[model samples]
Target: MSRFASTLPIASRAIPNYTTSEAGNPFVDGWYADPDTEIYNGLYWVFPTSSYSYDKQLYLDAFSSPDLVHWTKYPNILTTADISWAVKAVWAPAPISRNGKYYLYFGANDIREDGNMEGGIGVAVSDKPEGPYVDAIGSPLIGEYHNGAQPIDQDVFIDDDGQAYIYYGGHSRANVAKLNEDMISIGTFDDGTQFKEITPENYVEGSQMIKRHGIYYFMWSEGTWTGPDYSVSYAMSDSPTGPFNRLAKILQQDSAVAKGSGHHGVIHIPDTDIWYIVYHRRPLSETDGDHRVLAYDRMYFNDDGTIAPVKMLVKDNFADGQMYSWKTYDGQWTVEDERLTVAETAEAKAMLDTDFADLVFEATASIDYGLGDAGLVFRATNLSTSCDEFQGYYAAITSSDRVVLEKINGGKRTTLGEVDNMIELKTEHLIRVTATGYDIKVFVDDLTYSKISVTERSYSHGATGVGARNTAAKFGHVSVQRP
Candidate 1:
């Protein structure tokens, strides 16, 4: 059986729909980036820079999830009101809990001069994980640039021997330093040096370090931060302080999904080999440099320990009541009872903001009322308020006993192919459509074979979404994945 077949009931709605573990992309709402993920008190926590104008980024927010599917946001968990030296541009918070106290390490001010106020890498402490953290010290920890690296984008890694190390830097330079037991001061290395430059090949910024199987995996971001080529690369070494060699990039922008996919942190599930890369990417509908949203995807490794390329995809159950990643072209959409429902309208359409191509869009759909079809749309573009203004391909289950594959171009609807399939009214049915190049295939409920297949080449690259024509429809467990 397929992985989804064993997880979801196809014949009846006896249990909840298991779609991507009920987790959606951009798992939390709002614009956030440079996510630092940690397991705190049996829950997953992410501390990210509140993406905004530099002057407006004086605070940081936190999100905690018991499971990857559900999240709770703690707004302004830490702000400049608690720090004396930070005035503006507080960026990239890294959080860790130690000795029963929670510590947050962050960079502020984008400082360049030695006497430029009191901003560099700073530390804050709180009694609880979700904290109104206060500055641990009255000043910045590393005030001066070493090895020509700007002191920003700091990440903490705790070794098995109870030693904590910080990897940070920007301006194309990277460094590693040890943290003292006080957790606020730097410690010297074995060579009596306080800072060691371990810059790897193609290193730009966003330094992250992890240890797996006694091997040190050093990762960093590369390329221009504001451009689509921004991505993550890694290197492996046997020691914490290593003769590091650069390796290939493991996370990058998929034009079919989102752009500028970089500045990431890794999370390793306790007692398991499971790993996830929590990062930020720009939605296709957005253009601002600061218009970034936090997202995550499963990370895999080859047998030889090389990481696999991460695929940008999303699966939404709508259980969290967060829909920041979607754009409603025209609809009164609501999320309740784990369903994305659209009220009755001439044509209701809302597309997930990610750009999809050569992908599979799947959702369990049912019509509440009216005489029309409800299903999935792919390569959808030029959407608007009118029913027939969009250009794309649609695969829908009609009110009658028929499933259809359609092509919509400049408001003109063309029925490419259709089949006589039973579409019971007010009954939940799984609808899936795969479009690869010019080939289109639709699968309804039964996944053994395509119910409707056609060759439509008009629209090749665009967004995937849910749509209803002159009807009220509710969709559940909507998913878009690379085919």
Candidate 2:
């Protein structure tokens, strides 16, 4: 081990609530592949190859998130333009922080610059976690084949003793090596072997390792990359350099949705058991191999410390505010051309699918029928207090051209506040509602209608639906976001 390989510090971080169903998804933007996910400086980061051909894949983009929900993209952090010697195919970046600086280890030039055609891995450095990184050394760190293992899909693993090791592969083989403190070149163990072949049966590429509770878990991708057979499997051992026994499969193609799911990395929340599998998948209906998108799903462990199979879900975006976690509670509502339409129903509600803790929900709506009342329903768990009413706070405009904020529970409606002739009936108005704990505020056309301290505590976290009591309404730009 190197001199600095005794104490790799684990950062103490504020635990945001990443337990939502969306946590079991890849939340990054754009097409990307072969993810190496890490948490640095209290943020979650994913380093992925720009999913394209070798020429188009000459750069890597990094994504960061304060919580898993909101992600910001740092585009082209490192590219061939910055690495003077790099020609093509810069893929699979494994990042680690050292001495207050961040280092990104990556594979470039799928074939060596020389006639050998054996590609190599390279190193880049940057001061910040999300970097405009420059090449640390102007050349390949490993430019030749070793023990039949092609130098691609490199992953870095830091041991409990702080030893940094690298694993890489292709062509049904895998390799590992120790890294010197400079972190730009490979080092050898006391035994003097520069490369160790830990290739298990059915191995293809994408190698990664993590030590949990004194157990060494090794993972890799397998099968053909162009077909649905491409997937992730693992092996576990007692040492970082392993005579690893092949374990069970973890991630694979869900034929009904996506395929070619492979080339993965793992992230374990510091000082906690929470783990997430980061990878990419060929999206549905795409036949091109490079047409892949980054993905993630939470991973768990059994009592025996064995990992459970991944429970994956496709990511949902909040741009339309209708995609992913938002669900419709009641009312015959359908989303068409990003507009939410409420069928001329007699009396019902329409809420988002998520159980929001605190949020601002807004939509521009019109009661086109012009014959009845329309409102916004929020903090509602049950759709019906009676056959025709929902149990929650209701804020609306009456056909009589008045604005009222009321609570509907136990088959009774109690108006907390009302303003006569504040709204024009059957006209388009913006409905905005903010809910935080027991305090509720309602707005009509951006005008404040009610500020009430809700007395009922029966429902704390529930759905926010649109209200159409006796009218046909059309809603556009339905939006929800954290306040």
Local distance difference test values of all predictions, in order = 0.85, 0.73
Q: C-alpha displacement of 295 in model 1, angstroms?
A: 0.3
- Report, for all candidates in order, the number of backbone clashes: 0, 8
TM-score, per-candidate, Cα-based = 0.93, 0.66
Worst 10 residues of 2 by lDDT: 1-10
Give per-residue CA lDDT, model 1, range 275-345, as digits (tens).
Answer: 88889989877899998998888788889998888876678878776665677767799886888899988
Model 2 over residues 403-480: C-alpha lDDT tens digits? Answer: 778777756788877776556645678877777776667777755554333444545665566777777776665555
* Model 2 residue pairs with clashes: 26-296, 326-353, 327-352, 327-353, 350-465, 350-466, 351-464, 351-465
Whose lDDT is greatest here?
A: 1
Superposition TM-score, candidate 1 onto the true structure: 0.93
